[model samples]
Target chain A: MPRYGIPEYRLPYEMLDRDIDVITSLGVKIETNTRVGSDISMDQLHTDYDAVVLAIGLHLGRSTRIPGAEHKQVCKAVDLLRNITDGDKFKLPKQAVVIGGGNVAMDIARSLARLQKQKFGGVKVTVTALEDRAHFLADPVEIKECSEEGIEIFDARGPQECIIEKGKLKGLRTWKVRSIFDEQGRFAPAYDESDELIHEGDMIIEAIGQMSDVSILGEQLTEDLEWNRGRIQVDDNGHTSVEWFWAAGDCVKGPDVVHAVADGHRVAGSIERWLVGRQK
Target chain B: MTEGHSSDYERLQSKKSLAEILEVAVEFERTARDFYTNLIPKVSKQIRYLVEELAEEEQHHFDLFSKLKSRPDIEQLIQAMVDTPASDQRFSDAIHLPDLGEKPDDQAVLQFALGREHAAMEQYRSLAESTEEGPIKELFLFLANEETLHKNQLEKLYYETIHSGGV
Candidate 1:
């Protein structure tokens, strides 16, 4: 996440290097460019190590699963963020319609704005979200900067379809959101279908949420592991159902770097206690 | 003992040309790859996985060196040199799996791996310092970074596996 998730403008590579240097300075050895599942199996980790901690953060971007969401012009904000970070070349859009009201949505929108400003000499990005401006999931600073970059914000809109014309993306059709949650506080959005509008754009980006890639845990291990909702279940100290196995970070908690770091500390303490007991 | 090693390094450094140095590097990578590949089956599944990765990296290094050798401006690339101590195969040669006996424990294997990675890091750093700003210099610097990461991983594994109390 540090390398490929965050933009260089936000968190420079040198800053990351310094942070890593701090750990290496403490005589902590780290391996890079190694995939845990493919490079080393869970079974092997269980056999060899005293304890194994999974800090696999949320990587895959969640889809809105709305109609025409599978259009070629439709993309995920997380994937675009990663692509931008990696300096991967893609056709910069003249007009972009973002489908969410979160930091990730802002990140992609701002990034696209920057690219558009660079390539097309202007910013033409529209952010459409179900939440009202008062209840935006994104940070206020991000929302402010998103406008400062000349991107339009269309709050209180529920995405209905990716408006396509001649097999090409024309814009995003959205309905005016009446209420986002049900009476019981469930995530059932009530939209005023009568109130609809189409925000013209060449691209649509969905940044609603993120989920961890648990396929790395392997089939048997995944089935064996306990889960709370979609997240891996863990004790207060980060210990899992299996005694030697532990989970922390965005995979268990949520998508915040501070929380992940705190989780790391918690897991370390838990593992230390478990190991001491084992030695006894 | 240190003076003797320093003099030996000087002698080797002075006697070798760019092509000859690259040839030695190629040989080093090949040996390291073969060493890791052969050792994989003898170790535990987890260690074997690590060794397998190390072997793959060594092979990559070998390809990089080979490509560097075939570069048209290879001979003229070394415009400057730093007076850093260049590492040879002396450190790696001093250790062997056979010396640890058959069925060496995980700790012993990890320690051995750590030592080799340290040697590789130094060797690449030495190579990096010997060249001016160009692909050769960049390649060695990249290699040095990779080796440092490899050393770190081995050390981390060692601490976690052998000294679980502290980790």
Candidate 2:
């Protein structure tokens, strides 16, 4: 959805229904409305099948430790996009401040701009990011088109806090970002504290990035699984530490559809090879 | 990067200079129109008319963009309108351009053209969202509506050429 320019609308009803029809005709039973860690459990899945592969993607958005970040209007980009895609009719805010400089930021900014235009007759979205424009995380096309779409893009700006007065969001207090990387090229950001800018808005959205959800593994199983750098450690073939359990997709890699598809194929191949060897 | 380009882009985002936005918009419109003019020769006569029609509509949009850019006092209304919200119903998705090699078939050419018009329509609607009310926004709406018409027409042509044309 973010890579391809298509926004808001998915496939026309007939086409989507047809696609679902075809997928279902393949004799593969599919279930929607069920979620792991709650509606379903990994233990149940493993007991029902000989081998289990965990492909649970990262759905949680990273939050900042900034002051007043817990305001009701402060939200994640994914949550806002999901709400819009889910056809939620919301009263558009007078101003929306989006924190982050990635494609997800652009997605939220642009989508909200459309809604604001329909509701108020003009766009009022300001996107503030840590990296400067030259080093922005979002695709250059997304940046340019978003600018052309009238979304305010602020590069090299770091969010200090979500400003609130009288229990209401008033603006986002930010500092000018001096450097996004350390001398060793780490992800540490250096900001100019003296240089501050307060972007007034009714809402603040964090689009910095996303993290995977691994709670479905449960306490015992999760503790037993070897992990690396906050992600499940998997071999080149996507095999987890546990012989019978494997991991793939964003839970193993990150948030990317193409990567998820490639991971799916690799794990499938590994499963096939293992099954054949066992039979022999 | 310019010394204050970042700050400028931020300030510019909420309220853009009317002429600058229109100028860029004109370039995009012209590019989309010229896209068809260049692709017609690569396609057979079976689809040339459809391409020509698309090109003409895009050219009309280009003319509209130019006209909107030239208006006096547009700058004054620009700040106000730009501050106001504008509606856009057009949608966009990723699309690939028509490849010149492989002696591409009519179906491929039609599909590419269909995607192009779809993108153009979506672009105009998006531009409308950024543009303020009055003539400029109206111009964007006009061009966007025009692109929608072109997209629908192209969709029909594609349906006939593909579904009815026996693949």
Candidate 3:
């Protein structure tokens, strides 16, 4: 089994590991460290197998697009998580600011809290988001745990700019978010200018969203394949317009581990059926 | 309730033995007891206490069945137990003892117990329907009624939590 993306949630990791072990025990040769659309060449894949499955997950982090977002200290949430999980040592600042309200934001905030606890004898990770506490996207259990761990959370804040002083990190300026989405279901945050706060932080982590990088498909193949709102268009069985290529996982259905697993199963079944039919 | 004559009592009793019904009753009690025990740790302190009481009620059911099992003529009970449907097999299998090490929070536990009570009430109702005549049928009906009572109590607790934000 191919393990892509960060592994923090234990359920999918445990389930996938168990399944891979079981499948391997049954005499299936499962290759390891082969990242489709990246590490392994598509040419080699086409030459070796009749069909190629693209399960390359969405790892591209979304940007906040606020002023001073390009600062050296402002890092993507995924990168930070990957670095932490890989046991890489970094000098985390005394105060850190996390931007977003999703589960990913919660995970990074909690992880940073633990790290700060270990380093500074206390946690000083602050999470700010457009959504209120009740409307937060993080699971209630996660929110409760974060509160229990003493991580500071500020809700309904729309980031305006990262404050800098003499080319040094100072803090972040945010206006109170009156509302996040517009009437037409678009991202148009309305902010209350009167209600403004300057949150002091040495580092800022963006955990807004993620997308797939399809640039590796090359300009020629990109035009040849069907596209649906920037995502690769696939049939019900995960079959792409190109018969030889099948795509699944986060590349096709966004970043959900269970959805990826379900997509894999569907695409595998479809491939098996197609191959069997061709033999007949 | 009208007391029947000896001949009427014999006629009703002889239709199916008491031994069979007692067997099924024992199984149902075991399942209910296991479900309650499993649910205790998942609920709040008050809910846990309530579930413990439910488990005790299941023990009472077991004792009732045991008494019926010791009767001289239990042929009706035996027949009733034998004819019990396989639908309840799921209940028997799924009724796990509580895992004390990793207790779920209060809301989860209460919801679980509430669900189990609803399922048990349905199962007992079906069991009651499968029996015919005399004390065997009466016993099944009595157990079913008790399950309904437990279900009502659990429902009340569930609603109370929902409205009061206790869970």
- State the DockQ of every prediction: 0.01, 0.01, 0.01
Q: Model 3: how far is A263 from its true place, Å? A: 1.4
The candidate that wins on TM-score is 1
Candidate 1: segments with Cα more than 4 A from true spot = A182-186, B1-167
List residue ranges in candidate 3 displaced over 4 A.
A1-19, A26-40, A182-186, B1-167
lDDT by residue (tens digit), candidate 1, B21-139? 56666777787788778776775442345567778877987898788777777657543333334365563453343465654545566666677777778877876777677776786
* Model 2: per-residue Cα lDDT at residue B160: 33
TM-score of 3: 0.58
RMSD (Cα, Å) of model 3: 22.2
Q: What is the descending TM-score order? A: 1, 2, 3
Residue by residue across A4-102, what tens digits does model 2's lDDT show?
A: 222444235465567558878988577877987799787888788878888766565666547888888898777777677667766567999998877
**Per-model TM-score versus the true fold:** 0.60, 0.58, 0.58
Question: Per-residue lDDT tens digits of candidate 2, residues B113-134?
Answer: 6666666666667777775566
- Best lDDT goes to which candidate? 1
Distance from true location, Cα of B158 in model 2, Å: 51
Candidate 3: tens digits of C-alpha lDDT, residues A172-218: 89899887554543443568999999989999988776655565665
Cα misplacement distance, residue A46 of candidate 2 (Å): 0.9
Question: Candidate 1's residue-wise lDDT over A1-280, tens digit each?
Answer: 7565566777798999998899899998897777878998888888988888898776777666567888988998878888888789887888899988888788888889998988889999999987789878788998999999999999989888898889999999999989765454444356899999999989999887676677788756766777664466799999988778999887787767777888888889989988888889
